[model samples]
Target: MMIFEKVKSAIDMKTVAEGYGLHIDRGGMTLCPFHNEKTPSAKIYGDNFHCFGCGEHHDVIGFTQKLFQLNKPIDFVKKLNTDSGLNIDIEKTPTKTDISEYQKRVNEQKTYREYEKNAWQILCDYLWLMREWKKRIPASPDDDLDGRFVYALHHFDYAE
Candidate 1:
């Protein structure tokens, strides 16, 4: 089984919350840790927790990730195994290098999208400028302004 599934099945959210010093009542209500609240607004179900005060809801794994500020599931599972004595294998898990490479690719794609958007906006502005120049120039065939506007349009097209 995957580490996430294994750890999730072995661990109980209420027990983990209590271990973290949260007082859970009989109705599965506790003070929200994500936000300050005088009344109990966090509800702990069988393997999940929901905080009404903070509008945060998460399963056991998500709860652990948030509570400990962990960014990876493997780290959360490892912590659970060390702290709660739950054995979960980590041999087949993806390495940090793979995750970093994926993140880099995503960032590159976002940059390219931004570049494309800017290029499109520049093209639109140039087109609008050309239309406005046409309106300002006289109807005579020999108008220097018309030639200059055409030259500007041609330059912008080549630059793009």
Candidate 2:
């Protein structure tokens, strides 16, 4: 079944109204949220509501859409799926462009993560090597300093 049909069949208008913080009396009547009113003019039915004061009639989906001021009906469908735990599958088949764009973004993120990982590994190796070279001190003060030790002394701070 389509998402809208399934949702309408699975949910009641009164349940939806109450879920969104509207108070319903024993008669399933509540003050209309669409307009200011002191008396309860809207009557909630099984899958629809009718407002006597403003003449506003809407089904479950329409009521949710209007209640949230959402631009698209599908937005309310998603919200209903989450809030009501309907577990309805609402995804449409992706087009070629959509698949390609998704793959492109995934590839870009993967490439960036790999580069970051490799850079961090290289920096850690260089730092460890510099520390080892620092241990290679000359045997005597007059002895010639090892080139690697000299390089380690100069570049240890930069490597760190």
* Model 1 residue pairs with clashes: none
Q: Model 2: what TM-score? A: 0.55
User: For residues 83-143, what per-residue lDDT tens digits would candidate 2 score against the true structure?
Assistant: 7555455675445564455445445644675698699999999999999999999999999
Per-candidate TM-score against the hidden true structure: 0.54, 0.55
Q: For residues 1-160, could you state the per-residue lDDT of candidate 1 as single tens digits? A: 5667656665678756765678888899999888888999999998899998889998878887898989877787788656654433456664556445534544564467569869999988877776665455556876556665666656655644
| After superposition, candidate 2 runs with Cα above 4 Å error | 92-160
Candidate no. 1 TM-score = 0.54
Least lDDT summed over 10 consecutive residues: which range in candidate 1? 98-107
